[model samples]
Target: MSILREARLSDLPAIETLVKAAYGHYVDRIGTIPGPMRDIDDHRYARHIEAGHVSLLFDNADGEESVDAGNGDKPVGLLVLIPQTDTLLLDNVAVAPSAQGRGFGKALMQAAEARARQLEFDSITLYTQELMHENLAIYRRYGYVETHRAEEFGLKRVYLRKSLA
Candidate 1:
């Protein structure tokens, strides 16, 4: 079974590692076109965890009979969600490099949406670098529509939103 929970202070290191590993390639893959990806730093993530903006999702191999590969207690994936006045912003989503292509990102996002509704938020929002085509497509499939575009932190970012109301 997969579980979603609020990230605790202790999970900072793991979360940082996961985020960096998850997004570190974007800068290299896209070159300087989209500029840079900001969520790929360890200390940056530590700060997020300290500020209580991170959420964790763990997929226990044992709980999923179909997943024969065991990961012991390590988190296979994580989602960073920030709460706002009218929307829940998904700051980042990452799955372990060894565990990609298994729908972990999507499942984690679904949990985020549920949490947003529970918090009485009217919408969900996130921004992705133009270079991250796969991520943009995934968000689109999940009902997020492009809302804006900007260049932030040296990267061309496309913002997306989905109304829950």
Candidate 2:
């Protein structure tokens, strides 16, 4: 099983490492550093943690003891959830490359849905680069529908939304 909890300041380093490992490969495919790669900085994480917008998903399958036990339960995935008036924006979801095929990404999406419900959101929204076919497929498989397409910051972005109610 995996545990999801708010990220603490101490987890910043590990979170940064995970984000880099997860998004570094996309730099070549997209011809530029992905948004997540450019945005995953310690200051940004600190701000998000302070605002209660970041969550770390820990994999316990390895029988890890605790997050505070000196890297025992290192995070396998991270999420940046921003709650809006009627929706939760899934700004970022990154699963460490080493942990990729273990269902962590799907687990994190499920967690994000739960979070949206808990926060009383009626829907959730996210956007991905138009070139990221795999991501688009995964979001679609999770029931997200494309709402529109636009060029943002010079990247063609496909916005998607899933209604919860």
Candidate 3:
């Protein structure tokens, strides 16, 4: 079972560790550590947690497929959302490598859209590295359309957006 809920400040260490475990493998394929690995630190994670934008999707193996999972949530997924006037920016979405193929990532995406709708945003926007073909395809499959491409932090980025209405 998987549980999704807002992240607490105390989850900083777990968040940092999970982000690394989630994105570390990309360092070899992309020739650099992805932005999420470098960015998920105490300061940044704390800032987002305080703003109520960081959510965690925990796996409760002992539970019987429950959404809340009570208090037995374990390591799994992390999502970061930054609200803009017109759209919710998905700052980061990472799932622990060990937890892949378990639908945790998909759950996080659904959570992001629900949060965006709750905040009254019309759409969601996000960006991924140009070299991350798998992620791009998944985003497209989930209804995100490429808006443009740009370079930031010396890396080529493909920006995409999805309308909620």
Candidate 4:
């Protein structure tokens, strides 16, 4: 079974490591450290975690089945969700590359949507680097429609939104 919970201050280091391992390969594909890694180093996640906007997904809660290939205690995926005036923003959703294809990413997406409803938001918004076609396909498959494309934060980004109501 997989477990999802809010991230605590103590989880910062693990989240940083997991995020780097998850998005690190993009450096070659996009030519530069991904935004998340840079943000990690800047202690951005520290503020997010403190604000309760981060959630971690862990596999193998039962100690019998390890979703992270036996490293059950380690988080396999994470989601950073922040509430906006009328939309819930999906700041980031990352799954350990090694843990891909095991549904952890899907679980985190579901969590984001669930949180949107909990916050009484009718829509969720997110963005990804334009070169991350893999993420674009996944987000489209999950019903996020492209809202626009623009350069933001030094990265060409594709913005998307999903409406729940």
User: Is 1 or 4 the stronger prediction by TM-score?
Assistant: 4
Write one digit per residue (lDDT tens) for candidate 3, span 39-114: 7643688888899988888776678665342354455998999998889999999998888997888999999999
Tell me each candidate's TM-score: 0.83, 0.92, 0.90, 0.92
lDDT tens string, model 4, 35-152?
8888887899999999999988888657654233133268889999989898999998999888999888888999899989988999999999999999999999999999999986
Weakest lDDT window of 10 consecutive positions for candidate 4: 63-72
Backbone clashes in model 3, listed as residue pairs: none
Tens-place lDDT per residue, model 2, 1-165, is 777888988887787888889888888888887787767643687788889999998877756555541455678899999987768999999998888899999999999999999998989999999889999999999999999999877778899999999
TM-score of model 2 (CA atoms): 0.92
Number of the top lDDT candidate:
4
Q: Which has the higher lDDT value, candidate number 1 or candidate number 4?
A: 4
Q: How many backbone clashes does candidate 1 have?
A: 0
Would you list the rank order by lDDT, best first?
4, 2, 3, 1
Which pairs of residues collide in candidate 2?
none
What is candidate 1's TM-score against the reference? 0.83
How does model 4 fare in lDDT?
Answer: 0.88
Stretches of candidate 4 off by over 4 Å are 61-72
Q: What are the RMSD figures for all models against the true structure?
A: 4.1, 1.8, 2.7, 3.0
| lDDT of every predicted structure (CA atoms) | 0.74, 0.86, 0.86, 0.88
Instruction: Please report how far candidate 3 places residue 60 from its true position, in Å.
Output: 2.3
